[model samples]
Target: MMTLSAPLLALLWLVQVVCSAFPEEPGPLSSIPTEVRKYPVFLGRPHRSSLRQEPLHIQRILQVNRTLYIGADDLFRVELDNVVGDEMFYSKKRTWESNKNDISICRMKGKHEGDTLEMVGETVSGMARCPYDPKHANVALFAGNLFTATVTDFLAIDAVIYRSLGDSPALRTIKHDSKWFRYQLNKMVVDTNAGPHGNRTVLFLGSSRGTILKFLVVPNQDNTAPNNNVFLEELEGYNPECGQDTPQARQLLSLTLDSNSHTLLLAFPSCVVRIPVARCQLYSRCMNCISSRDPYCGWTRGSTCSFLRAGTLPFEQDVDHGNTSYLGDCDLLQESYIEEPDGLVSVNLLVLSAVSAFSTGAALSGLMVCWIMTVKHRQRSRGGGSGPGGRRKCEKEQNMLG
Candidate 1:
């Protein structure tokens, strides 16, 4: 075997130590897929009207290309790109409990200078009393029609879906005699494009318990029902958690859908939970349906996927944190979908390289100091040795002096 110098051996040992200390490369942070194109769309801020002190409880958000419409507490606000101010419209009855409360619908028209949002139509469906203590009215538009539901006497009161006919004041009801419309209290309702055969679907969420129910409206030959109206059937139902009468269950706030991914994001007191629409469609279940491929179904960093615990702020807090607006109603506006650049991998590589460089420098510096000390110790021992060669040299010097 070839002999190696002390410094060389020490350097080899140092490298081995470093290799053992750190083996795997740090992974990159995962991100959702981005849309292809983007336009500068705007959404108005909710709770802009002073009469309502509380921020407008955003019930439903709809994007029709670049124009965005937000339905909140019996008010529909409209905003358009290049437009300076938001146009507000209030339905006849403002509170959620009144018998004559109407669901409001707004659609954009014309160009910026002379643009307007026509109320078009309203519905005063008398179903049940508000279930929540301070119950708020909820409204949503689907398949070119409007659907409103409120909690009354601890039961879900859904208005018969209505379709608007041009600028006329006439409102038609969607006639469907299916058992799906039966009494089960629904606190919030959201519209989705994931109906059977790609038709529009409505997702209803329960108030007292976090029960998610889906209803599909399919077109039928029954002209007795309107052309826009179809047979309403219960597609699926699942409870996110078991213990209903607890604080977590009582905190059941609202539900929203990400149309792009078909993901259902549910909000409570402290945390937000995500459920996959694809998984729900396939399994007809919600429990254990959360998977990596699912959106918002996973937990936030260093947090559990269960009920959002107390002491943690809601995701909406990110909106006005530091007085910075996160996403206003107008900002919810969507144009052509824009693809976000894939920079996560590059960022991870950069971070790993920096850390590796720093660790290598620290190890090399330590090895260099140890090597110098070893060499000096060896030299000192040799000088102090009483070996045969050193003794003969000392004897010769003494004899010459004598």
Candidate 2:
């Protein structure tokens, strides 16, 4: 018999913990054969998310040219790129030589006349921006910056390939059921891909609790409308701690995706880790793939279910490319088939949880009963023996004297 690797053992342990307490059975999602399932590939082998020597003390993190920069009180670069140029989204046209800044900007000429002009993505440096204090009693800035403040007068907003900062809705973390969404909103990432919708955009919100939520952002029916209609009905969520009933607010300082290696870097409160996005391949069976409500994922004709836009490197698309489901004229997914709301995994977890609760409750009840019996026996032994109840002042005094 061969001994298991430390990492594999650790992963198995984590699975037991997370899977056993799953909120509900993953329904059919978890019912597929293990062979057909795209089990996660452990890129860093026994890849743990929070194992850093120093405490994760940053507020935000950004990936530029394969370098991960963190922001909290200050911005600092982490220079641990095993494969250089793996995490950045854009190509560097020129070498940067600057003072006081390590992350350099590679300028691209504007293609359209109406496009917002600036050094990088439209915002110019050193322009006097009206800094209005939101906490101020009554002062604000809205109309002067724009040609007009009227809702009808449309203002063209400059955006990029990333949906996180593009024309999307306000980030809402609450669930539809009114249960408080447990994760603390830390950072957001937009995954651009071709979808059935048109230009597909799925937003990934990282929380302080180490959970990453997959959200769908659909614009209003009117083309010119601009207000976040965030549909918190998520397809899947990843919590690094796995199966923790109430996960602590362990902030993910930043998230970086390595396109070349198909890896993802997550900076947590305790440590930083690299996980393979290739392993996150959600669908395998074509039917299941089509059934998954994940917007950035799709089932190819070849029976391969992966990211909808995986093959397109240096992926070029108008900022609004949609999901593959649009192309799938497949049947609508049944309520039991969806993975987001509930899964068969949750049922297993619930059963284990119920048993655990009952066991604990019974143990506590037995202890309470024993304590009560002991107190009753002691009272009978005392039998009005002036134990401060005061049968009579003289009798109480006699018992106290005895």
Candidate 3:
């Protein structure tokens, strides 16, 4: 019997719709591997008797063509196919000496080594300096540059991108807000094929808070311009309601991408999860798919969402604008979602609720009036002694007595 205010009813409706759209306890989408192979790539010891034994911590390892480039206490390279099986992989590796004592090799001097990777006379003099300190698992090579996303000091976190220019390497560094210590960035993966042109460098950064942030780095055609890196979005890796014991358990340690499958792998302290690079399946309807504004997804002719690859004809997508005008007379548009702030509702819902309340009140009022009138009519009929029949009976009784 309670009549809720229009605004309150509208807010309740909005909450219900949003909750239905995105469930709190989401169902599982994929499975994790129960078993994986473990292999040791490198060993750290006093290389044939030295004065000191420097700790060997590999910061990053990347494979290009057939060669595997490693960033560790010293820059190392080996054949990718050779680093497998038993003790046969160990060979006489050529090491380069640097004048700097604590040199964590984060970049390679390709020109100095040239066609012949001569061991003698080559040094770590012309290589780029290591951008990250305590450099362990904080570097990525993407689009011909070395990128590091790590905490520089106690209060500063930075994402530095650098590359070698000519025969002599010069530093071309772009730091993404060193002063921004909101979230400690753990690891990063760069994707150059994010857009149609394949020039838009998209960085997927894993943070310490179990979150992956996507950034779109604008190409610096003019080197003098300031860095134009745009923050795209942040994806949640852990649900807070799952009740983790410690914050360390939620930290993401590794981020890797498989281009052939278009899958992004995330490694945490507790488990490893694989997610699609573009989640097109979430958009079940045509309107949702078209409005997602994701370059990697589209609504296909099969009436399902799928990856927008080459020869994917008759697919609907608008990455730049998400314009729905292209979808002429879409029946699914009615099911489109509307996002509103909490404790607030749209004007259309408010008006509808007000009209509904008014109609309900009017119906109740009419029912009350009809009930009262019916009761009064019954009382009047009873008092009149069933109309003329009661008067006739009284008269006949008096006549009989006389």
Candidate 4:
């Protein structure tokens, strides 16, 4: 019999003792109420222009009541209604596109009966391009009274932010003095409900280094410029390490703000990160966990936790198992659930490790016993065979007697 070393036996016994002490988690009961989790909203594939070979650049996001406004590369603006359905319906009545050279603005109206949006009104600006380049323009609505757009340009290349006065004929401009190479005006969050008299702030993603830059745009009483000049002020900036090259960074493909809390939700390839506006400076981030009040964190197939530099929350339970398909990158907007029928439920790592070790010990012991038995049987068979000399002697004695 194979004998286990003292240390190995003790170790195996300890594991078994611990496993016995810790009871297996009970299965889900029908009587218990499970909390449903919500996921980040993901829009469909970004719209790109045929004129340019570059993929569509989703430059800015504007959330107005129940509608979402999207600004993209090649001067395209799209509006999506906020409703639960297979395909998000776009408003066909209001859409705009600017010319390639940044000369004129084209306003188009769309009609949507069910799911299809058809173009209706198409108005082109008299000027082929705006006096400033549209490439650098960022758009925002301020105080429900004025729309402002700002631009920061390099050399002859201009960056502009455009704000249109709802039905008014006038347009406002907020110009940037600093030299900029490449930049993306990503998102705008208006904290009207928080600040005095509903102040507005805009968030943008700077190119090359992927810096998150924020700007405050408001009505300026001291207007010296002709374009109903609006004041543009820099609020704050953060480098999410999101860049065009790094896979982890690139996964931060999109961002949006919670309408109620104004918390920023950054969508990545694997998981979504949430940065509360109050704690933006500290870079305090929270990720979705298998069990968290935060709508973005939850359990799915192949679910795993990646510790942020700040580590995880104390109460947060690390995910132990599940497929990540429900947590796909480009599809964060869809809601998910941790149903009881979704295969083996998650378990504690410590428990699993201990069980595996004990099973391995048992298997090794059985193998040693089998080997010893086989050797003993072979020895008995050899002893039963007669020697050649003994057999010859017996035959000679029998011949003499005869």
The numbered model that scores best in lDDT is 3
Compared with the true structure, the alpha-carbon lDDT of candidate 3 equals 0.56
Top candidate on TM-score is: 3
Model 4 agreement with the true structure over 144-249: per-residue lDDT tens digits: 5554444433322344444443466555345544444334454444433322223333333322322344333334566774332122222222222222345333
lDDT of 3 by residue, 245-264 (tens): 36755656567775655655
Better of 1 and 2 by lDDT: 2
Q: What TM-score would each prediction reach against the true structure?
A: 0.25, 0.34, 0.38, 0.25
Q: Please, what is the whole-model Cα lDDT of each candidate in the order they appear?
A: 0.40, 0.44, 0.56, 0.40
Query: How do these models rank on lDDT, best leading?
Result: 3, 2, 1, 4
Window of ten residues with lowest summed lDDT in model 3: 31-40
Once fitted onto the true fold, the runs of candidate 3 whose alpha carbons sit more than 4 angstroms away are: 1-182, 195-201, 216-232, 239-245, 333-402
Give the CA lDDT, 0 to 100, for residue 145 in model 3.
45
Count: clashes, candidate 2: 30
Candidate 1 per-residue lDDT over residues 1-402, each given as its tens digit: 989999999999999999999755322122212210111111222334534323344455554543334555543434323233222222223345534323222223235654656566676444432224444564445444433344333333333433443354435455444354333444656564443223344444544444454433344568686544222222222232212235333344556565554545444432233444432222111222122122222222222222222333332111011122332332223111122265544333566799999999999999999999999999988987678878988999999999
**In candidate 4, which residue ranges exceed 4 Å CA deviation?**
1-63, 69-87, 91-358, 361-402
TM-score for candidate 4, residues paired by index: 0.25
